[model samples]
Target: MGLYDIIFYLFAIITIASAVVVVNSKNIVHAAFSMLLTFFGVSGIYVLLGADFLAVVQIMVYVGGILILLLFGVMLTNKIVSVDIRSGSIQVIPAIIALGAFAAILFSIMTSTNWKSESFEIPTTTSVELGNLLMSQYVLIFELLAILLLVAMIGAASIARRDKE
Candidate 1:
């Protein structure tokens, strides 16, 4: 109907389609590439929602950092990266039960929750405010994330080293 609606739907479709590709692709490399497209679509949606900082971070953190590392790991490994996806109906009963439980919980939440209908103003200085909050209110959590990333990098390096020896 409107330009915003069209753009939102376009991004949504791209995100969902790419996500499906990422999930269903048998080749790890292709799946990783599809994940990049999905991330890009999500980042676009974030930008549309006036979350520029989040959009940039999504691209940088997920596409640039994690996805690159995943691709590198898959490419550099000696073992086979492509996995055969099995669709056996061995757990049909359990799957049906789980789906039913999930649907019931979702329905209950949707019916019971008081959803907000009011529109909120988007702050122009979102990045500045976010930066200030990270430095002031959430410094510890920020530092912990950095430390966790460092530890993960070290672990990955160690694993790669072991593979060589």
Candidate 2:
């Protein structure tokens, strides 16, 4: 009906289709690439929802960081690319039944709810507010997390080095 609605549906379709590809693809590399598209779709949806900070975080953390790491790991592993890597069995009937039940529950909930459309001011920028809060109130926790990640990296490097010897 509207541009926003069209964009939202597009993102939703992309997310769902890519997620299905990620689940069903036999090749791990293709699955990872599909997952990248799924992440991008989710970030687009977040942007449509007026959550700019979350959208950026989704892109940066999932696409920029995690997806790249996953792709690199898959590429670096010699045995994974050579193998078929398909699951031993498929449970199509059970999956279909579960999907039907979930759809029914969702339809019931949607029908039962009294939907209201109200306009509210969406913040133009959330990063500034978040940064202020993190620096002022949650600085200690943030610093601790950084330290923990640093230690983890050091430990991982040491383990890798020991394995080489």
Candidate 3:
């Protein structure tokens, strides 16, 4: 009905559609590119939620860094581009049953919940406060994420090198 609601729905649709594309695409490069759109949609949603810092970080870390690296890895691999990605549907019945149950539960939760209706003021300088909190409170988690990424990259490099040789 409102402009914000329309924008929110638009971004949400873009994010969900791109995520579906990422999941369904057989080509690894196409999936990686779809992930970029998904990340951009998420960044737009973050901006709408007044989380500018999170939006910037999402673009920088996911779109700029991880997606680029993943694309390069896929492109650099020999004969990987021509490989057909086959997805199995062996658990179709179980998946349908699980999805039905989940839908029922989600519907019930949405109907029964007492939702809060409030407007939030957008902060002008969110980066400064977010930076302070990350440094002071969430520094350990932040550092651990960096370490985890480093380990994962090293592992990937080692696996690629082994495959090449």
Candidate 1 local lDDT, 8-91, one digit each (tens):
999999999999887667677788899999999999999889899999999999998999988887766635454542222366
Count of steric clashes across candidates, in order: 0, 0, 0
lDDT of 2 at 109: 100
C-alpha root-mean-square deviation, candidate 2: 3.2
- lDDT against the true structure, per candidate, is 0.86, 0.88, 0.86
RMSD of each: 3.7, 3.2, 3.4
Q: What are the per-residue Cα lDDT tens digits for candidate 3 across 29-118?
A: 788889999999999999999998899999999988989888777766636665753333467689879988999999999999989969
Put down candidate 2 lDDT per residue, 1-165, tens digits, no spaces.
999999999999999999999988877888899999999999999999888999989999999889998888776664665576443338978998999999999999999999897978887998898899899999999999999999999997887574544
Candidate whose lDDT is highest: 2
- Span of ten consecutive residues with least summed lDDT in model 3: 80-89
The deviation in Å at residue 96 for candidate 1 is 8.4
Comparing candidate 1 with candidate 2, which one achieves the higher lDDT? 2
Query: lDDT of candidate 1?
Result: 0.86
TM per model? Answer: 0.77, 0.77, 0.74
* Residue ranges of candidate 1 with Cα displaced over 4 Å: 78-108, 163-165
- Alpha carbon lDDT of residue 27, candidate 2? 76
